[model samples]
Target: MEQGSHLLFWKAVNTVILIAILYYLLKKPISRFISDGINSVVSRFEKIKQEKEEALNLLKEAERKSQEAKEEAEKIIKYSQELAEKEKQQIIAEAKIAAERVIKMADEEIEKEIYKAKEELKKFAAKKAVELAEEKLKVAIDVESNKKLIESSLQKL
Candidate 1:
């Protein structure tokens, strides 16, 4: 029993010495590895945070640009409508002017045609009167008197 107890005591002392030696030898490397792992994790978290910020900024910019585009589209539509209205008015005005000019020309043409008709009627009436006078004169004049008048006019010539 004394020999077994002595042997156990020696074994316990050896185990303690071995543990101490190993701890002293490996402590710095283990600590450095743990700290490096923690730093790497922290760096990854920071990178994620920065990416989130950049994404938010990009989203805001996109929203702003979308609003600007909407406003510009409205402006363009309004300008186009205004231009169309102006053109429509101008076309209508031009049509009215053309219609008035055509009416005026038609009136002038009608007056000219009326004047021509009146002149033709007057000429016809004068011709008819002259024919009637000739008929009357032929009936009134005697054949012997007409012969004497013609003979006298020839002597004067």
Candidate 2:
């Protein structure tokens, strides 16, 4: 029993001395390795953060461009609608003018036809009056009487 206790005490002292020696020998290299690992991890985290920011900027730019395109499309649609309305008004005006011109031409033609008919009626009346006067004269006077009347009218002239 005495020998076992002495042996146990010596083993405990040996284990403590061995731990102290290994710690002293490996401390600087272990600290350096741990610090390098921490620096690498920190740099990786910064790179990921920068890449996330860039992706967010790209997304914002895309959204802005999309908004601009939508605005431009709306403007184009409005312009087209206005242009079509203008063309429709112009066509209607032209049609009205053409209809007015046709009406004026028809009125003029009717006036001309009415004037020709009036002239023809006047000529017919004049011819009919002359024929009636000749018939009355023939019934009222003989050939001899017509010669005497002609000589009398000539003397008066």
Candidate 3:
């Protein structure tokens, strides 16, 4: 077997040229494209992370405001309860006063009715007694001697 130095040298030169051409024409563009795509992905991930952090902050603020509103509502309910209690007490006081007035009025009316009934009974009794006395005198006297009895009684007095 006879080896040719000429073929070996040509192969070495050809491999070197091919490596240079590939590096210049394909390796740089492919590497640059891959690097740009990785950068874009990393930037998009950062943007999403920032947006998530902002959303969490907003949620926290909303929770705080909701708690404040609940506290305010409880205070208002307490105030209204107090007002209702005061109104109930006032109503009870007014009712008591009204009942006292009504009792006093009823007592006065009863006293007036008793006094009027006594007066009416006395007047009726006096009228009946006067009629009975006139009837007894007429029974004891004679009709023919009525004028002579009257004149003799008048002269004796």
Best by lDDT: 1
RMSD to native, candidate 1: 5.5
Q: Which stretches of candidate 1 lie over 4 Å from their true place?
A: 1-19, 128-157
lDDT tens per residue, model 2, 1-157: 9999999999999998999998998888999999999999999999999999999999999999999999999999999999999999999999999999999999999999999999998998898899999898889899999899999999999
> Model 1, 19-111: lDDT tens per residue?
999899988998999999999999999999999999999999999999999999999999999999999999999999999999999999999
lDDT of 3: 0.93
Cα lDDT for residue 48, candidate 3:
96
Write the residue-wise lDDT of candidate 3 on 15-65 in tens digits.
999989998999979999999999999999999999999999999999999
TM-score of 2: 0.58
> RMSD to the native, candidate 2?
5.9
Q: How many angstroms is residue 27 displaced in model 3 relative to the true structure, after the best TM-score fit?
A: 3.7
TM-score for all models, in order of appearance: 0.69, 0.58, 0.71
Better of 2 and 3 by TM-score: 3
Question: Where does candidate 3 clash, by residue pair?
Answer: none
Best by TM-score: 3
